[model samples]
Target: MNRFKKFMIFGALSVTLLSGLAACGKSEAEEKKSSKNADGTYEETITIDVFDGLANYMGVQEGWFAKIVKDKFNMELNIIAPNVAGNGETLYQTRTAAGDLGDLIIVDKGQQYNELVQAGLLYDMTKYYPGMKNMARFDEAVQKMNEGTDALYGFPTSVSSIPATSPSEGLEPTFGAYLRWDLYGTQNYPKVDTLEDLLPVIKSMQDENPTNESGKKIYGFSLFSDWDGNMLNAGKQLTTYYGYDESGFVLAKADGSDYQSILDSDSEYIRALKFYFEAKQMGLVDPESTTQNYDTLYAKFQDGQVLFSWWPWLGQAAFNTQTNLNAGKGYMMVPIEDQKIFSYGAEVYGGKQFIGIGSNAEDPERLADFIDWLYSPEGVLANSSQTSGSSGPEGLTWEMKDGEPVLTDFGKKALLDGDANMPSEYGGGTYKDGVSALNINTVLPIDENPENGFSYSYTLWESYQRDNTNPVLEDWSSHMDGAVTTMEYLEKNNQLLVAPGASYVAPEDSAEISTLRNQVKSTIVEYSWKMIFSKDNSEFETLLNEMQKTADGLGYQTVLEFDMENAKAQNEQRVAVSK
Candidate 1:
């Protein structure tokens, strides 16, 4: 047998052996009570292993979020995060082949998910459907997801109650050209008209501030290799600034008007690569960037060694400590005149992330209950606290006052006071550490909570918005002609390019297409990095040409053709939803 086939057989034998051993140790009553009761509660506290594809943290979950689930369902979440396991894709495949991908599974809703269904690794959740009251809120979405399936295998994440065409993001796009507003403000906020314009501006700021507080050398551009897949994630992310979304090998325009193969000489992906090359040439790129992981890069941000950021979360959240914010020193979005930021509109069916119960779950019914609660208002508030810095649990972190939600003293301290310790009643860890480790949301954070008539996003809450402004925010607003937020400014200027959300799932790639894609992707990823760090423009051009040639020989055109068709289908959905 082949190596994978051998592993599969060994996995089956191992599972059978483990099951037999467990059966021998279990008492008849213990076995009987292990399954969920008719009341949808477990007879005893159970440890639920969550195979989370999106989790940034791994191991057993703890702190306030843990306490909430434990108190409610007598369960503890033991998260198995592939992202933190070193190699996410490999971990996923290995666990999948082992026939036990944890009791609760969260992953992308695509080929891998279909494979799991075909392998009977996913539990049929149809029996518990009636009890999923909160989940039923997205009835149309769920129906669309399981259209051809015999049973309700799973549902997508970040579902919204808003119309499909409306933008779901509260106050920021997923990607942006964020900068240290404190530094920019000092420099009189130089005008940035295009991506190229950012280079000179960033260099000027870098020259002025050579080091951070502790005198650590700073860089205008610090990249990470950890998140790179088919192409450099750092480079690919730049395409979003121009309103393009990654669709397999192609970058599909947000308005569904155009698509470009990443390998195309003049494509945005290539342009981004050249941008990084120029940054490197100018001595503004971090020397350790190519070798650094995301964690290292994020730590650099916290130390204020980075001046530019592509996402609101990365630069703003990591670096904007309470002290910095209090001092009017923090990061904020700096708009480029020629940019049209891509926005994934509030998806009524949610984004492509899928959550389902594993077939090997000890108590699938109880898991069903846990997942259902995630869709409830209480769960949305508590579980999605990471969403745009939202607070959790009405009484614990926030409460209604004068018919509007406001943060309590504890909430303010825990959330904004830079890792304040939580009360012993709320699992005792620092508030930051106490947030959910799953890192997946059942509903959009921007979705309005029916109970409060406000978005689950604390940043978007009227009371919070009114009280949250600092000097940095005020300065940014003034610079942007009184535009209070990046999303607002983008919308006002027609600079936000939203891909209308629809109940659309791209067709699974053909076996031939999948194989071709893997080979082509490997080549692209390897050469893309080489091109970015090339010795000179001549070397870069040579590397790029070599990469394209090799990839084309490996069937780049075949995969590109497949992706183009998928892109066309995606556009059709966008059009349908727009109507």
Candidate 2:
């Protein structure tokens, strides 16, 4: 039997079992049905199965977020996380073959999504679009995806409202060198001229504060391998510090002026590999990096076992609790002079992922309402709270005070306290557990909410700015020309390389190209990791040369040509959009 047929048989068995159970409690079921409110929402609680490609957490969504959805729509979410389920790719293929992705679907906007669209797996969400009040703001964004087709598959996630030319991030660049402020402060804040300059500075910090309070040794860098793809994700991420963004396997300069093959000896990727290798040699690199996942690395940050971070969000958010900041200890950006940090400008059409309903949805209209709510200001605040630095729901976490937003006492604790607990009414749990598990946002937190006249991000709120004062921040400000924020410093010094947002979607790869890409990607990732942990310089060079030669033999040149053309198209669109 085909997979779809097997899925049907399994589903039928489930229905039969459910029917038998229902028969045993017929009167109770009838009473529950009668208890539903007069509103459009069903009285019988419905469980919506969400197959989310991006989710890190799985199982029934719980805590305050569950309460919010239940109160609003009488619905429970059963999240299906492919990453957690097993091998992500295998799960995706199996589910697709079974003819039921889920009641709702969320995935990145790439080959998989395109294939789903062509296969008619996604519902046409266009009819419900008219009813989505907040979604109107991104009409062009939704339309952009459905240009060649008559049906709308879904709306993109992380849609930004800022001008296309404006920087997407607020207080800090997405990629930068963040160090523990308390440690760096002791060194009189040594200047970081090049990426290599960080070595001695990190060494000094690690030497002085050799261990955490619990007596575990700290390292300058604690990396993870969970996100590796076409190349070592950490290594590719390091290239962003030098004003380049990965376009397929190519490193395209942010200014749209140039590109480099990852195999090039002088490429930023190689430099990043060498940086980690040297850090390893200096005993500043974590030995667990190759084996550890992101969660393990993150826990180390919370314990103050890591001294360096490439992104402010990862290190700063994990380490900078209210307690730490109060004690003048936290991570803060220590800019490198040679860095022209690449910044993604506002993406009005969203980024790589999108949210859509599956074709097998039992209640399309109800699911549509739920999705529409995701685009609403209220839903945005509730779902995105404490995520990407957004202040959550107005009355609960924050309040409008003196015509501006301020975090309430609960808000402050809930938002910044590492071990905060929610009130029973909000579904008692730790604040972290209460956060939305979908792991996808319909709009970026940095976007403005028209109802409140403030961006969804708490970092941009005037009240937050006024209350953000801390010993660490003050010290950093005093040392850096009184610049209160990293954004201000980068802007004033003209060090940010903002990539103008354009409605550019990379074309789907041909089948031959796709096969070649997978092979080349595997080789690149394998060699990249090997080079980072190579025994010596000679071994590192051998690994590098072998990687390049093997990749070329596997058709790297063809892929590079394809990516170069995309770079050209992207540059043209960026220039036009900026104009």
Candidate 3:
């Protein structure tokens, strides 16, 4: 699977794994459960085995960062994570079904979440509602979680209620369409209002500059099947062009119609697919995109083989100052007409990551308090950066200056190394591949902070300076002229970032619906490649028909009617909760 896909499956579990809780049954689970502390602190250590290697990186038993978590909360956290990455579906399916789930539960959205809900694996969050510290303030996320049920079951992470952009900030477009600005500038900046317009522009750039500095051939675009979970791939993923789908199920509202399968000929997803087919014909789409995993795909980005990116962060390693600032190499494109969503998030619960107290958690109150702590200003700051101010390792990693958190050069060096001073137990590089949000801390709010927007989040909380470099986007933006960052563009267009149609659907499990949904997913995954890599438009057309036929036979229409019914019902809840 691709890195993105792998993350979607394992990231949540990696953060929520409880080797401790998983070992216990109902009897043992109660014994280990924590009790509420009168002083809002615990005197014992809490073990979290989210990491495969167990959180050995920090000698949390004695590490300065550990000391901070302990000192602040009066509790010690023993974190654990994997030393490598892998798909976690089997592990979860086996453990959750066995009723030895864990002390905490964190999972991504999809059929799995629904299954867990149906299986009664989740803790009903009704009793805690709107009362967990700053949680009520994150209303969108709260409402999103409230969907499909009268009670909330999970909390989302990495959400920003306000724009998280700043002067010269890197454009983190939620829509996967992005381009290398350096090449676009070389062609004198053409006006591109449609997907077709992006064609020759990328072609000319690839033709003009055939290879990168590393002697690798450069291509106009790249795709990955790894992120194609549930049998999805680039073709259907482009449905983010419409908005996030709970399943790969798509609905296009632009043509004065209700939600329907994106597999339809007129769907924006198909149009984007056709665009790729044509781009492939021009030798502009990277062939490796089909074969490479995320690590390899990311290496290509760093190597400069891929000129454009579907996701914003995928292109970051190649985004040094020389290219982005000196040569003006990259920028996000404005949303297209058929493309309507500003962002595809869990809205609150299921977009990126989610958290819930384990059904077997020993102390539900303690876990709730712990979760509440995570939403506080202090917890947000800690999860954001490696270590800072009182949360980090003092002179060794960070220091306070005039009450402001700063990463010292020495500390930056350790952080960049990732395993520096990671107590002997940490034993290897800090828990697996370099992906954001998977940490010793389970189900954390990586995007939380005590700041306003980019102005606050960027300058202080989200600064890029590990030690030497600082504000990659800020520096690059200084050299940029009249650049329209993602936030600016969205506001200018009066776009609304709303919950996806699926999110509005009831969370209740429907066996028939799920069966049909998986069948549709399989069809899309199998045939999307055939259509995109077709030798001719006729072949693409032929493949499209085959997919539609398979979908229809599989009861795709009935699924849609069911979806519409549920969506209308859920939409009412969505509107009511949003208010």
The lDDT per prediction is 0.79, 0.80, 0.52
Model 2 lDDT tens row, 68-171: 99988888999998766757766776676665678889876656567666555677777667877777888888888667778787888778778888888878
lDDT per residue (tens digit) for residues 482-570 in model 1: 99888899999988898888745667766677678777887998898888788899999999999999999999998888888888899
Worst 10 residues of 1 by lDDT: 1-10
Residue 55 of model 3, lDDT score? 20
**lDDT by residue (tens digit), candidate 3, 300-326:** 776667777765645643443333443
TM per candidate: 0.93, 0.92, 0.71
The per-prediction CA RMSD against the true structure, in angstroms, equals: 5.5, 7.3, 7.4
Show model 2 residue runs off by greater than 4 Å: 1-38
Evaluate residue 14 in candidate 3 and report its C-alpha lDDT on the 0 to 100 scale: 25
